[model samples]
Target: MRSSEGMPFSVVTGALWLDLVYTGGEGDRSCWEALHTPTDVAAWAHSSGVVSDPSAVRIDEADLRAAHRLRETLWDMANRLADGKLPTSDAVAHLNAVAQRADPVPQLVLRSGVLELDRGRNADGAQVLSAIARDAIALLSGPHADRVKRCAATDCALLFVDTSRPGARRWCAMSRCGNRDKARTRRRFEKG
Candidate 1:
């Protein structure tokens, strides 16, 4: 049980992947805007008071684009469910082509001279997208794995790692998004 648990954590190396897929960062620009109302990712600010920590955030615009690209890539890889068909060699070949065209990940370890697509920061402070095949494989099979989900809050599209106490968290922000949602209804009834 312990060893199996470690594998899921390994799949969560960076916050980038989760931020990209589960949030409105998944190329749903209109949804992103509606959720923010007058503010968008460009103008919005990270709430330092709420977060109180720096290491946990990965939702800036560049990370946003990277996450969307990865989401599409992953979607193309294996089918959406465990019972679904395994990824064909042809599918991998296609993804590799797409990864190469997008950008080369650092790719520190290549077994057979094939480009292993890792993504995110490299030691030199440059972005490299290599050597991620193993981690990606772990992500699909690990316990932390899921089909990914968007926030259910109608006006809040922020995403999260559902490492919830019961694996059921519904909002990106309870005080902000969730509270605002409740307040809007309260005002409506009072006005009527």
Candidate 2:
């Protein structure tokens, strides 16, 4: 959906790990390169909700490489699960290794006189990736594993976690692929 300012909304797949995968786009077409530089990775970390402040996070060339590797591995595994195939043992091992790299240190903070658990602003690239990988582990191994799906649009292969009540979601975003498919179908019917 476009905002009042006429900018399209950012589509989130209900999970940060899946969000990372979508950054690479589908097939030969790329949405945009969000990990081209260490600075870009830092910005993505903040925008993707991996960190609170982009400036506070330290991302280096090595970190960028690691992020790219983890993202591709995750995309492959997610697509496999969506296609009713089991993830390979090697992919599982890589995920485990990334997740064990560095976990974000959680801090209990007092907000409005209530205690809340939060990953504070200060973090490194490895910590950001580990958090994402850890989330992937939980999602792949958890009850919602079967809910993973690729968009039904023939040309769009974005993977998403189907959190609908009936688990019947067929589009990455209704405003995008879903609407396009509906319009195409209507046109075909008119032609008939």
Candidate 3:
């Protein structure tokens, strides 16, 4: 599905990480946009694994609003962490409020001879949002917080955690920002 910015929706960086990157930038030129409708939010929720099934849950405008708020908060928090500063109080408070709305409980179940962990039934929209908020909080406070980085593509504003062994990752996704940057560099050299 397309993002509100008309860009194709991206999930390469991880659901709670940069799924909402499509919603930021300067005004007018900014891609900052909405999910369009509640069904779009529901589809995102399901595709991102925020909910088990899009068909099983009903998302409303309120739910989409909440998700937007949480997504913005997460983006702010991540940028703060990347800049070596604590997130603003408003960001922390928003995350806390959303995180309290749902708690994921893991259950261990035996399947044949192996025991596996399952998160149980699908979460509602609020719970799905909570899960994402909690994940952002964890990333902000966790050891990998230092690894968060914005894309190196001059035109891309997406952020992602550098999980590479050397921590030298530079793009949100190789096929997207990485390839674009490479092509631009190649054109510049060819002109020179």
Which candidate's lDDT is highest?
Answer: 2
How many clashing pairs in candidate 2?
0
Winner on lDDT (1 vs 3): 3
Candidate 2 structure quality by residue, lDDT tens digits, 38-95:
8888888777766766887878999989988888888889889989999899999999
Specify the highest-TM-score model's number: 2
- For each candidate in the order shown, give its overall lDDT on alpha carbons: 0.39, 0.81, 0.69
Lowest lDDT 10-residue stretch of candidate 3: 21-30
lDDT by residue (1-192, candidate 1, tens digit) is 011124211122123333333324334343532223212221221221112122322344554444345445654443333223465676466445433432222334465877553332221101122223333545656764663334556653344445555766665555555566788889999999
Candidate 2 residue runs with Cα over 4 Å from true position: 1-9, 25-31, 108-118
Q: Residue by residue across 22-135, what tens digits does model 3's lDDT show?
A: 544335524456476777776766666666556656668898777777776776777787677888998888888888876444567788999976552455668767777777
Candidate 1 local lDDT, residue 101: 30
lDDT of 1: 0.39
Q: Where is model 1 more than 4 Å wrong at Cα?
A: 1-14, 20-71, 74-127, 131-136, 157-159, 185-192
What is the C-alpha local distance difference test score of candidate 3?
A: 0.69
Query: TM-scores of the models, in the given order?
Result: 0.39, 0.83, 0.74
